[model samples]
Target: MEEIERIVSGKKGKIDVTPIATIFRNEIKEEVTKGQMKPRIVAFLTTDDAGAIEYAKWTKIACNRDGIEFILKKIERLDLEDAIIDANNDDEVHGIMVYYPVFGGMLDAYLQDVVSPAKDVEGMSTTNRFNLYHNIRFLDEKQTKKCVIPCTPLAMVKIIDHLGIYDKSLPMGEHLKGKNVTIVNRSEIVGRPLAAMLANDGAFVYSVDISGVICFQAGKRQGTIKMTETTVTRDEAIQKSDILILGVPSPKFKIDESLIPEGAVVINFAGCLNVEESVESKTILVPTIGKVTIAMLERNLLRLYQNQMQSRSTSSSSSSAQIDQPQQ
Candidate 1:
């Protein structure tokens, strides 16, 4: 850790995300207020983890400000699955979020699968995960509606764009085609998904976990992703990365600061500090993503609401056409 201290002991810089989040928040607020949209979202908190509670609180506050009907429902871990199903069955609820670490491990994954795909605002369901990894843009075979993305990864990508890293002049699939990136967490929710998202966008990615490093990159075919074990050491990957991401949940775990290259972009989404304070001097540190997460959460809800509206309109139009047809 001392080595980390030595590397980042000087100047400091960080991306002020308030403006970016505000842009999203105001857009949401204006759309809802102007359109009179009452998109309802219910977030279930089944754990007493302070971080989860605080996140849920932020989610509710953001929703309220955006003029959406929001509820923070507290329930026991044992009943979370059933409660999610109830919310899924309720026509009034447009979106749903679950505070995680309830049961931890595969059980939590099972709970993720239980949430209805249409209402899973966080986009943590199995189907969404499949769509993300496979680069499927739409929820249906017709390809009319777009798929929902996990908020955190989307926020991170936004950060890169906001910071001027993404060359907008470049086409979509090639926006990040030239960058070498490193992400230091491999958890199912955040790390794994993020790596795939980056790879899908054409970045060469090094995904680091306790076991080892996995290489991720766009495949030879368009919209395809590939991952394989790599001989590149963590330090080597960090040294070469244009973008560095950290999401370790515990303070006990941290990047040895010495590994971070000077002027590299580093982003942290974890509640605890995953990198030393000094590293800010040597890197472009995106220290928090909570606000953007909230914005993305509401954004996903609006998308689902819009899809529902479109579906309703299409249904109505078809019904009218059928009724107007001459008797045959």
Candidate 2:
């Protein structure tokens, strides 16, 4: 694939993802503009956070520009579950997304599960997550329909691939086999899923969280994830890592600059970047990906829309085949 990356030229520099994002937007626009009607995504925001609100606004703008329908529904937290069910059952809605931190904890997890898999564009639904962690890439026995992946982590994968870290000549699951990675955040939304994704793709991953650092690696079995609890310290993990992906929401939770090693690939998904500005010079730094993340959201919506179309076509064919068969 051609490089779509933008460079920041100065004493301190990092990778600007605007061009990569533009490539994704152009592809999605081309993918949807051919059809008479467009796929629709319903996003529910039950939080009052400024960031979430702004994200919703941009999501609408991106979707509109890509020829996809976008709806932002600000509703009561209590009614959010019921509203998701309604959207799930609604035929016109091709995809669903929920802005986070609403009811933060187990309740938010429950809300994630409420969105049906077919309409889950964010790929946060239990079924999609389960499939992702298990390294299951398809939705059907025939493998005709593909499964959805969470937008942020998928964007991370794409960015890493664009950087040429993943060798295309290698087998699918063996691309990152020799690399050691460290992921700082362990949130269900991004970190944990990302750790599993890399581990599944054959990286030895050090998953760091508030609790401790755990080692994630590909399982002995063909399609499984192996998690091993470790006493590895954050700095230790950072020192040995080939790639470091960080995401932490708090402004006070910045990563120590001295911890980053030379010649490492650094990717940050935090709204408030967790790494120091100077680290940009020492590493292959990806400071932010606001547009690229939005692009992944649009891509997921298109994939789910395709899945829906395939399901309809299959059902219609089955019905016609039954009608054309001899009466029994």
Candidate 3:
């Protein structure tokens, strides 16, 4: 852990992440009026898993440091109904997130209940999803944002955006946009949401299923930019892409020097636990910890905080107006 942190610290000069998160946070705080207002509450809905707890802690710190109040909803040995009700009734809680996955179809039902549309920071609410599909998902007219973009997908895009230098020599949206970028697994949190997010960004994304097409699309989209959920090392997959995003730490797939295109920019969002075979020295390898995890959590918290501020300002103004009206 120390070595990893040191490695990340060394790269700080090259990639400054502080400003990136600050910019995002300020964007959220901007929507509110400057004055006395009700305190904003955010709930960190999570499970007993250590990772989830750690993530919740990160979120709590970020929120508190920014003057946002937060609460934790841990579903350790608790029934889903009780958990959902507890989350819903917490008036101080402006957002709800479910960090743990439940067994059977019960998880879906619980998610729907725990996350109210207005407070769905992670955008898992059925109503918010409905609004998303209908194209009406935004707090303001010109905002042009989704109600809640999945954290991982948002993290991936932010990293890409921060990188700035996309090889534009290969055309813009149409070339990479909507091209069949294949995802290996189909988890709702990652694959489904990622596919939707990427597609919304104008990329033709395909969440790989057993029956999906395997033939590469000749030119660009056919064989470019593969972002995988799990490890699947196909020589054709490696030889054919311009950008590769790896999101899993499983040992199933390993990239060899021969597999990747020369000078390919690879993003290992899978964290440092799984390192593929070293390619040429020119291969640009990006680690996920400092890049994706923190960035994504920071971004989501910022968005959620912004939405909370907006809601508070509106509520305060409405209350003031009502109070000003003479009693009947």
Candidate 4:
């Protein structure tokens, strides 16, 4: 098998995210300084996943010097409802994030319960979802506008922007507009929101579940960019589009040399691939997507947090000033 192309790694070599991260950090710090705000406090509630713990740890570290605090708690009880209600009591905790795969159907409800609309950093709450769906208020005190957007989805958008793929000054959205972009999953966490985000920007987004993938053939080419959130759909989608975005790491899978479209860009967000068979002469497979995505998530979360804080402060000041002045 020939080597596959790795999009994230290749882009990393070309994309200097340090400047972006620095700018983001400075902006947030500036806001905190401007507001004379106290240190931020974060809380995590979720099942015990090493990845989740590590992510929370690093995020905490990043915010440490910047007057942001973080806390992590593993949910032993299956009752997330209680966890959320308890989260409300911690006035210092400005952000609430719930990790994935927490058993039962209570994840959403729990998130909704724990996260005040302003502090929904993960953007999983129903209120935030509704706000995003209606485009009611994209950025709050947060500059992003949308509340409760998934971290990954926001990272994808940021990555695209970093690459100058959709800068408003350049008539952005052509690459995705009306383009037949096919996503292979429908998980609310990823598929649904991302599809809506792309569609709202005018992309012709089509979701192909596991069953819809049976119809995929290696030889048939259809779209300009085919993105997959599951390993099962990567090879098929890679073979059909000029650009491919790969996420998920269920297990290693072989990538036949003939399975790639010539000159295609493949981004392996999974960071886990069968090296022996995945090697393609023309393909590039990135092994650091997991790390980069984590970074991206942290960056986005911070932005969302700052935005909320700023918005709240501005509103409070305005309300206070109005009250002091009385009727006009």
Per-residue lDDT for 1-328 in model 4, tens only? 0011133334322223444445455666566668666544455456666777776776776666444556667666466556655554444555666665565477456545455655566666665655555554553333443445666565555554544444364243344443334444555555556656665554545455545542211111221233434443645554565434445455554345476564444444442542322443454433333333444444545655565555566665311110011111
* Candidate 2 lDDT over residue span 1-328, tens digit each: 2232333222234788777888889988987877655799998888788988888888899889989889999999899888988887777888888888788899888888878777778888777777888777776666766878888998998888777789678898888989999999997778889999899888999999988899989898766889998888989999998898988878788878788777788888888888887897777788887788889988988887887777787785311110111111
RMSD of each: 6.9, 5.4, 8.6, 8.5
> In model 2, where do residues sit more than 4 Å from their true spots?
1-12, 141-144, 316-328
- lDDT by candidate, in order shown: 0.80, 0.81, 0.50, 0.49
Specify the poorest-scoring 10-residue window by lDDT in model 4: 319-328
Task: List runs of model 4 lying over 4 Å from the truth.
Answer: 1-23, 29-35, 39-41, 45-47, 65-67, 78-80, 104-114, 138-146, 167-175, 178-180, 213-237, 253-257, 271-328
The segments of candidate 1 whose C-alpha lies over 4 angstroms from its true place after superposition are: 1-12, 314-328
Instruction: Show pairs that collide, candidate 2.
Output: none
List runs of model 3 lying over 4 Å from the truth: 1-19, 26-47, 104-113, 129-146, 165-182, 202-206, 209-235, 249-257, 271-280, 289-328
Instruction: Tally clashes: model 2.
Output: 0
Q: Which 10 consecutive residues of model 2 have the lowest summed lDDT?
A: 319-328
Clashing pairs in 3: 178-203, 178-204, 217-222
Q: 1 or 4, which is superior by lDDT?
A: 1
In candidate 2, position 227 carries an lDDT of 96
